[model samples]
Target: MAASPAKKRILVGQSGGPTAAINSSLAGVVAGAREAGAETVGMRYGIQGYLAGRTVALGEALPDDDALALLRRTPSSWLGSCRFKLPALDAPEAEGFFADAFAKLEADGFDAVLYIGGNDSMDTIAKLGAWGARMGSPIRFIGVPKTIDDDLVGIDHTPGYGSAARFVATAVSEVARDADVYDLKSVTFVEIMGRDAGWLAGSACLAGPDLVLLPEVTLDEDALIERISVLLEHQNTVVVAMSEGVRGADGHLIAEKTVAAGTGVDEFGHLAQLSGPSRYLAGVAKARLGVKTRAVELSTLQRCASHCASEVDLDEAFELGRRGVSAALAGESVRMCTLTRTGDEPYAAEYGTVDVLEVANKVKPVPREWICADGMGVTDDFRRYVAPLAGTLPQQLKGL
Candidate 1:
C-alpha cells in the first residue's frame, strides 16, 4: 500500500486582551497560513478553549472578504478573550494539562499553533511549545505580540500601544485646546490606562511639552493643587493628564486604592472595577483648590478606537503576524515574533524571532532617563521614540 499524505493543520488563537490592531494580525496570520498550504483553525477563546476541545475552521469562522475587512478594522478580539493564567510548568497539574491538550491537537490533526497576545500570552506559547518539543509531538508554536500596555520586553513596542498612544495624545491635545478657550473657572483631569507601567499616560506628554503628568515623577499633591489654583486664578482653565497606575509616596496605585471595589469578579478572581484617581483628584481640586473640576476617563476608548489607529502600527502588527507564521513554517518553536528598532531617524524596524521565555510575563518599564526631573513630563527622547509610530499627521479640521 502507498504511504498516506501527512495532515497539515494550523491553529491560531487570541490569548490576551484585545487592541485596535489585533484583528489585523489575525488577518495576516490567516492569509499566510492559507498561502503556506496549511488548513487553518481558530481556537475559540484561547488556550482554555483548546483544553476544553473547542475549535472551529478558520475559513468558516472568519468567512470571506467583508467579514475579514471588518475583522481588520475591529478593535476588540472578535473570537472573544479570556485572562486565564496558565499554571507554572513545574506544577503538578501542568504535565497532565499538556498531555491532554497535545493529544487533542494531534487527534485533531493540528501541526502548528500561533497565539496572538501580549507578554502573558507569549508565556502560554512558550509553555506549550516546550512541552510539545519534549514530548516529541510534531507541533510548532509561534507568538504574535499585541498589547496597549507597551510593556513587553525585547520588542521596540507592542502593536496596540502605538494606536492607543496616538489616541491619548490627540484627545489630550484637544482637551488642552478646549481648556485654553474656556473662561470658566475649572480644572480638567484626564485619566489614562496603564496597569503598572505608565506608557499610556507618558504618551500624553506628546500632546505638548508642558501638558502631561507622569507616574515616573513623585508628584507633590500640594504643589499640583497650587499649580492648578494658579492656572485657574490666571487663565480660568487648566487641563491635567494622569495615569491610572500613578503611585503615591508609599508606592500604592492611587487609583486602585481609591476606586470603589466592584461587586463582580471574573474567573480569575480579579476585581472588575474602574480606576478612580481622576475622579478623586477632581474632588480634591474642587474642595481644596476651590476650582470646578471635571474628570474624563479615557478607558476602553484608547484600546478600541480603530478609526484613529496609527497606520505604522497597523502595518507593523500585520507584518509581525506574517513573520510569525513564516517562522513556525521554518520549524521555529517556543519563539515570539519581534520587531526591533534598527534606526530612529527614518523609523526602521528589523523583524526577527526571540525566545518566548525571555519575553514572557516580564514587563519593561518606561526609562527613567526619558522622564523629566519635575516628574510631570517626558523628555524629548521619549517623544522621539513615539513620534514615528504615529506616522503622518492628520489634516487639521476647520469649523464648517
Candidate 2:
C-alpha cells in the first residue's frame, strides 16, 4: 500500500504594517487550515515573536464562526506585527539563530509556516526557507501580501490597497470641499503615504487634485509653484496631492528639510520617513506664491479606517490568505500567493504563486505610462485600471 500523506501543524503570523483587511486574511488562513485537517498556531507578533517563543493557540483563541467573523472586520494586525529583518541564511550568526527558531517550531510541532505581510515579511519567508533547506528540515514557508503602500511585487495589487485607496479618494474629495469654504484664493496640500512607491499617493487622482506627484518622479518645486499660481488665477481653491517620499531633482527627499532631525532608520535600513513635505510646501506657497495655504497629513488613518474598507479588498484579502495556506498544505515552500489579473474588462483576478525570493526586498512602483506626460495628473487609462478596485468615488455635494 502507498504511504499515507503526512499530517501537518501550521503556524501563521502577521508582520510589518497593518491594514484594515489584514485580519480578514488571518481569519481565512485559520479557517482554511482547519478545513485542511491541520493543527494551527498563531505566532504572536509574527516571526520576531515566534523566535522569542511567543505564540497563541489559534483554535483556542478564535474557536468558532462568530470569533472569526469579528476578526475579519477588526482593523489592524490581529495577532500583532513587527518590522524585524532576518539576516541571510549564510550569515555568520545564522546557524545559532536558526537553531533556536527551528527548536521552537519543532517543540511546538509546526511543520508549515505562513507569514502575512509585505516586502520585509517575504524576506523572512525566503530566509527561513533557506535555513530549512540547509538544515534538512521539513518545514515549509509561504508569504501573503499586505500593505497600504501597494508596493509588494509579483501581484496585480495588494490586499490592503483598494480599501486604503478608497479612503484616500473619499478623504481627499471631502478635504477639497472643506478647503473651498473661504472667499480667499487658497492652496491645499494633501500629504499621502508611500515610502518608495507612489501607488497610495497616486490614488488621490480620483479626487481631482490639480497636481498629483509620485515618488517615481522628483518634485519640481518651481513647476509646482507655477502650476498652483496659474490655478489660483482662475480658481478660488487648488488642491495638490503628493507622496511622502517625493524627491527633488537633486535626488534628496523633500521631507529631509522639513522633518525634524534624529528620526531613526527601521530594521529594513529605510529612513523612517516623517511627515512634513505638505507643511513645508504650505509655508513656501504662503511666502512665495502669496496664497493662503494649508496641509493635511493622512497619517495612520489611511491604513486603519476599517469603516471605509472596500468589500472587494476584504474579499480578495481573505481569498489570498486561503490560497496561501492551501498552497503550503499542498507542499509548496518559499512562494508568495499573488493575484494575477486575467481580464481587464470583466475585472477578474486569479490566484497564483511566485517565488518568495523574487518578491522579497522588491518594490513595485507605479508605471510611467499610467502617469500623465505633464506629471501632474494620471491618464484615463490609469482610471480604468484602478476603477474596479476603488469603489464609490465621492460624489459632488448635492443641492444648495
Candidate 3:
C-alpha cells in the first residue's frame, strides 16, 4: 500500500528502559526517514514529552553524519525516555487525551509516529494506532524493539539483551578468574539480570557451563550450599552465577527473603531489590555454614555498555528501525518491527511485523525443558535456542 501523497512528516520517541543498542534504532529511524524523504522530529522523553509539547527537529538536533556515527557507538536512549503507561483506551479520559494529542500531532504536521521501547511501549503504539484508525487520523504508529529483559513476545530476542548478555558472560568470567587467585577459602556469588525470565542469567552459560545458574530452575538452597561447601573444601575458592529472579522450591526470591528481614523499601513503594542473587544468598552461605562470602551485582552497566554491543544485535536493531518506517509509510498500523531467526548454524534473521497486541505486556519465558533437572544449569537444548540469537562472536573484545 502506498502512503498518502501528503508531504511525509514523522515523530519518533524513546519509551521504557534504556538499552545499549537503543541509539542504533533511533539512528535507523532518522536515517531511513530522511532517505525516504520524510521530515523527522523527535519527542523528548517519550510520550510524556510529546504530551507536554517537548520536541526537537531531528535534522537540527542530530546532523546526518553525527547521528549515523553516534547510532553505532551510543548506548542508552539518546532522545531521553519515560516509563509512563497510558490509560487504557476504554478509560473515560482516554478518548479525550488521545484526541488532544493527535490534534497536537496534526497541528505539528506529523503523519507518522515511531515509538522505540519494550513491552509496555508496544501497547502504547497499539492503542494509538487503533485510535487513529477509528477516528480517521492519518498518523501511523510503529514500535521498534529495545529491552535487556528479552521477555517481549513474538520477537526472537530484544536488541539490548544480546549486549547485556555479553556483559554478563564477561563479568562472570572475570569474577571467576579473580576468585581463583584467592587461595583463602571463599565463595563469590554473582547476581545477574532477568526480572522474570532467565535469559540474561542463562547467558552466563556462554562464559562456561560450570558457572551457569538460571531462574527457570527451582534451586535447592541446601544442595547449593553443600555443593559450594564441597568445592571450597577442595579448591579453597568458588564462584557461582545466580539470577536476581531465582527462586527456591518454596517459591520465594532470595532477595525477597532479605527484604522481608528489613532491608526496607525505596521511593517507588517497592523493596530495594538488588539485581542479583548474590547478596541474599551470600548472607545465607555465611550465616548457615560459616564460609567467607562476597556478592557482586551486575546491574545497569549491563544495559548501558554500548562499548560491548554485539555487532549482530546492533545491526538488527538498526534494521528493525528502518523497517518500522517502511511499514508505517505503507499503512501498516498497530505493528511491532521484529527479527525472526531463519537459521542458526550460519545465523540469519529476516525482518517482519507482528501484531502489537500479540506482544504488548506479554512475557516469553525460558522454556522449562531447557533447564537442567537439578535446577542449577541449562540443558544443551537451551544452548541451541540462545546461541543462534547471540550469533557468531564479534571481533570486538567481549564484556567491554
Question: What tens digits encode model 3's per-residue C-alpha lDDT throughout 1-400?
Answer: 9877876998999987798888889888988888898888998999999889899888887786765877666888888998777777899999788889888988998878999998878988988888888899878888998898898999988988888877777777778777767557888888887767888888877766355667667778889888788776677777777788888778777667655455665432334565536787888889987878899888787888776678887888888888889998999888999988888778787899999988887889888888777777787876776665555554332544
The sequence of per-residue lDDT tens digits that candidate 1 reaches over residues 119-147 is 77888888888888888877898999999
> Which candidate leads in TM-score?
2
Candidate 1, residue 245: Cα displacement in angstroms equals: 0.6
Best by lDDT: 2
Q: Tell me the lDDT of model 3 at 96.
A: 88
**Candidates 2 and 3 compared by TM-score, better number:** 2
lDDT (CA) for every model shown? 0.80, 0.88, 0.81
Reference-based TM-score of each model: 0.92, 0.96, 0.91
Give per-residue lDDT, candidate 2, residue 5. Answer: 77
Model 3: worst 10 consecutive residues (lDDT sum): 267-276
| Model 3 accuracy (lDDT, Cα) | 0.81
| Candidate 1 error regions (>4 Å) | 1-7, 62-70, 230-234, 262-271, 397-400
Collision pairs in model 1:
none
| Backbone collisions counted per model | 0, 0, 1
Q: Could you give the C-alpha RMSD of every candidate to the true structure, in order shown?
A: 2.6, 1.9, 3.5
